[model samples]
Target: MLTARFKLDPEDRVVSFHLEGHAGDAVKGENIICAAASAIAQTAIGSLQDIARIEPDYQAEDGLICCRVSYDGDDQDQLIQIASLMGSVRIGCMQLEDSYGSHYITCIDES
Candidate 1:
């Protein structure tokens, strides 16, 4: 099974996320669920660093990715950009969960 954990701030913004594990529903290279989940998570983080120009604290390894984005209340534009990106990640993961069902994948949000 695959699991994603999202940590949210008081404003319900995604402050951080940890995604790991394989869906194990198929052979490793052929797991569509895993591929979709990984694409969503990686794209969001990549956008943060490359497009948004923010270097979030993060680490990555085989089947594992964990990241945290920092923001300032004074910079609404930056906050909005980051929030939007994070929201996309959350939305993507939830969509996968909805499609694949909890038996293969799980997404949890933490306050």
Candidate 2:
């Protein structure tokens, strides 16, 4: 199963997110669950770096993706944009989890 963990800051903003493991719902190349998760994650990362211009630390590999947004006190606009992008990712993952409960799990941690 795929495990997706979203870590939030005191203000309830997602500071980091980690997605690992495969859905195992189908063969490696034909898993729609995995494909949906991957697309959401990659799109969010691209938006954060390209549109938001926020240089979040990130790593992507087969069946694994980890990203942590660095907070800049002086850049509230950029931070908000990043938050929106991450929110979209979270929503997509949540929908996947709801539809494929047995193949995907989502956890949120607040700190």
Candidate 3:
């Protein structure tokens, strides 16, 4: 299964997200679950960098994606944008998990 972890701050804002493992729903190239997850994750990262103009720390490799956002505290606007984008990512991940329980799992951690 593909596991997605969202790390949040005390105020419930997402600080980072990590995705690992493969969705063995189908053979290698035919895994729709993996494709869906990748699309959502890549879009989230792209939006943060392209639209929000926040270059979050991130890494991606075979069956793995990890992204971290460090807020400036002073930039409320940027913070809001990042939160909104990350929220979308969380929602997408939850929906994917719901539809493909056997292939996907999502978890959220608040600190």
Candidate 4:
């Protein structure tokens, strides 16, 4: 099963996410769950760096991805954007977890 993990800051803000196993779940277009998970994760990472202008420590390889970003507490814009983006990550992950019922995917690390 695919595993989704979110690392959170002390205030419960998402600092990073780690996903594994989905990309290899099936042949192309065979697993909708894998595609949806990939989309949600990639969008979150791209939007954080490209749209929010927050550079994160990240790594990507076949069937694996991890990204972490530190937010500036003094920057209101960063806080707002990060909050929303991270919330999206949380929601997307939880929705998948709920809908798939841990057979296709599982959420971890208090996410």
Q: What is the lDDT of candidate 4?
A: 0.79
lDDT of 4 at 24: 41
Worst 10 residues of 4 by lDDT: 22-31
Report the lDDT tens digits of candidate 1 across residue range 19-103. Answer: 8998999998689998898888888889998767788888778788888998765777777889999889889989999998988
Most accurate candidate by lDDT = 1
lDDT for each residue of candidate 2 in 1-111, tens digit (9 for 90 to 100): 888888877777788889898888789868999899989999999999899987789999998998998666678788789889887877888889888794455645546
Q: What stretches of model 3 exceed 4 Å from their correct place?
A: 108-110
TM-score ranking of the models: 1, 2, 3, 4
After aligning candidate 1 to the native by TM-score, how far in Å is the CA of 62 from where it should be? 1.2
Worst 10-residue lDDT window, candidate 2: 102-111
Clashes of each: 0, 0, 0, 0
RMSD of each: 1.2, 1.4, 1.5, 2.2
Per-residue lDDT of model 3, residues 51-108, tens digit only = 8898889999998988999877788888899998887777888888888784356655
Q: Against the hidden true structure, what lDDT does model 3 obtain?
A: 0.82
What 10-residue stretch in candidate 1 is worst by lDDT?
70-79
How does model 4 score by TM-score? Answer: 0.85
Residue-level lDDT tens digits of model 4 in 1-111? 778888887888888888888634578557787778778878888898888888777787767777777777698887889878876876887898898778878888753
Number of the top-ranking candidate, with TM-score as the measure: 1
Q: Model 1: how large is the Cα RMSD against the reference?
A: 1.2
Q: Rank the candidates by lDDT, best first.
A: 1, 2, 3, 4
State the C-alpha lDDT per candidate. Answer: 0.88, 0.84, 0.82, 0.79
